[model samples]
Target: MDISTALLTFLHILIPIYWLGGDLGAFYGSTFMTDPKRSVAERMMALKILNNIDMAPRTALILAFPTGLALAWAKGWVQIPGEWVALAAVACLAWLGLAWKVHLDHGGGGGAKRLDIWIRYAMLVGLAVAGIAGLKGAIAVPLFIGIKLCILAACIALGLLVRRALVPLFGAIRTMATTGPTPETDATIIQVNEGARVLVLMIWALVLAASFLGIATPV
Candidate 1:
């Protein structure tokens, strides 16, 4: 790969790691969700993780589009049906917008619930298509594409599950906008921290898929 392509590929891989690892750390950090935790310090640690979890997704969202577009441009792979292309673009835009909301709205309810859910569903589609497209010239089309696609799907699903899991806690925060975060709310955030494992999985999947595609030189 040329230097530019190499850097883009590296960024693609890095974004997911930063995104998933950060998100996963935040998710798994919450050990007190189902339980009323015995220690205040532990809850505090989990809350800290939750506070930063948004950063991962936000960064990933920024890179996903341009990298995906660049890959297609570099390979002249824009042969996707016009309709599919339009759909892909729309999905990309929507995903970006939703991810932005996740950060702009942060932990509040200013419209993140719906956006978060839709982002996962849309990304699930986009990742599926892009991953398959990566198989066009691969050395191991069946095994590589299928496995990577599966991993991406699982990552998207995990993202969705985490979003769903966070709804109640986020709602609580919204409800308590005036009252401020309580011990219970803090615990809930910590609970979400346990989902960090999913983010880590996402990061790994991105690395494997991108490197495989580059090596496969799929077009």
Candidate 2:
């Protein structure tokens, strides 16, 4: 219960709570945005709210990696070298800064967006490799840790999938704003939002599973 361990433990618990809570807020806002009964202005407002609230979950997701690793080290569940753990924290912080820059740029593409995309792709591959290696005993780690890593990889993948699915919805929203809400545009928005919702649910499930594994460490 030293200071570093206490702080890591607090973060380990706090991140998921905010991740799930923020996601729920964003989900609700998205539902409002998709409501045909709502006026365009109202829906637009909801979309804005959703975007702002979503930062919480996105930030949590980025920070989870280093915090989880630090927690594992603190609890003696893993023997990651101290320097490696510190490097992971630094990398996570750098990623977080890149993520915020991308958010502020909002896909305007001064290179932050591209960098963020590549970073996510790199993370996806790295997590997959680490998960497989840990599970196969190439890395000396607990089964629970390996499974948690795999689950986290899945969560990241699902987040990307959700983003892809929502692209069409954004386009449709623009069209609706310009051309007025036609049936086709509304239908497209609804369909894409539904697909994104499914992927989001999967991500939430994986995150909860990872959290449970962290707490229980069930082999």
Candidate 3:
């Protein structure tokens, strides 16, 4: 492989490592955070740590698209304009910056969070459309690549669902923090986690599927 292709391939391989690894950490943190047996302070600490650990997977996910696009271009799998690729890089960087802003400021309900979510919606829609078109032979995309795109889109959708499910859990956490843990708050936390767990598992499956597609190309 050419040096550029090799580098892109390396990045392509490395991202999933952080993405999956960080997710595992976040998963553990979530379980610890929701345990009713744990002290309130301990649960709060776990929640804080979970948020920080989640950033790794978030960063990996944001960069995954641009890296895959650039790799495709470099490998001659698709003809992408240099300007378009550069634009993608810039946009992803901006997205990453916005995400970090939300993280550092600890502002969960603001314009920044809304903007980030909107950007993810755009990415999800774009990937979904591209994957469908590629699979239908309406676009000049390779079969395995098309499948991988769809897998990525599924992952993003699952992530969004997980986020939505967690909103209630956070609300419960706030209630618990203010008034101390109650059966209601604990139940809510458990319920939300149960729902989110399913979505998270789906995301894990999609990530694994995408990795397999990239590695084996078994379309």
Candidate 4:
């Protein structure tokens, strides 16, 4: 393979590997956080670990767009314009920056958080539109590629759902930190975790499917 193809191929392999690996670590940390036998401090540590590990998958998700597009272009699987590919790379970088900022400022003021949420919504819409266009022959790509895009969009949606589920979990953590852990607080943590786990698992499955489609290119 040439340099461009080699680089894109490397990224294509790396992204999903890190994404799934990080997600598994996060999942394990979350399970520890919900373990009733663990002390509050231990659970809190697990939560911190979970949050930090989650950044890997979040970064991968943002980067996937540009990387996948570039790969498709390089492999002659798609004929996207160079300008569009450049625009996508810039946008992906910006999105990755915003995602990290939001993570760093988890419970801070409004601006960054609001912008990040809007960005995610915009990405969701963009991916869905791209998939629909490809499927409709507006974009010249294989059916499997379009389906993979749709699955990726679904994974993003599932991520947002998991975030929504974790809202209460965050609140419960704060409550525990402020007033010590209680049975009620523990129960709330466990409940939120269970709900989030379902969504997260769905995301994992979608991501794996997308990866398979990208590799197999099965129509």
List the candidate 4 regions with Cα displacement exceeding 4 Å: none
- How much lDDT does each candidate structure score? 0.57, 0.87, 0.88, 0.87
Most lDDT-accurate candidate:
3
Task: Write model 1 residue lDDT over 54-168, tens digit each, in one string.
Answer: 5676556445555655544444444444465456567666667666666566446756756666656866786677566655643234344444554565566666665566666
lDDT of 2 by residue, 60-165 (tens): 9998889999998988888968899999999999999988887787657668887887888888889889999999999988999888888878888888888788
Model 3, position 120: C-alpha lDDT score: 89
lDDT for 170 (candidate 1): 60
The residue ranges of model 2 lying beyond 4 angstroms of the native Cα positions read none
Q: State the local distance difference test value for candidate 4.
A: 0.87
- lDDT rank order: 3, 2, 4, 1
Name the weakest run of 10 consecutive residues (lDDT summed) in model 4.
101-110
Clashes of each: 15, 0, 0, 0
- Tens digits of per-residue lDDT, candidate 4, 21-56, equal 999999889888988788878988998999899999
lDDT of 3 by residue, 1-219 (tens): 978889999998988999999999998998987899999999999989998999998899999999999998887777778889889989999999999998898866599999999998999999999999999999998899888888888888888888887888878889989889999999998899888878877888888888888888654
Candidates in order, TM-scores: namely: 0.57, 0.95, 0.95, 0.96
- Relative to the unseen true structure, what is the Cα RMSD of model 1? 6.0
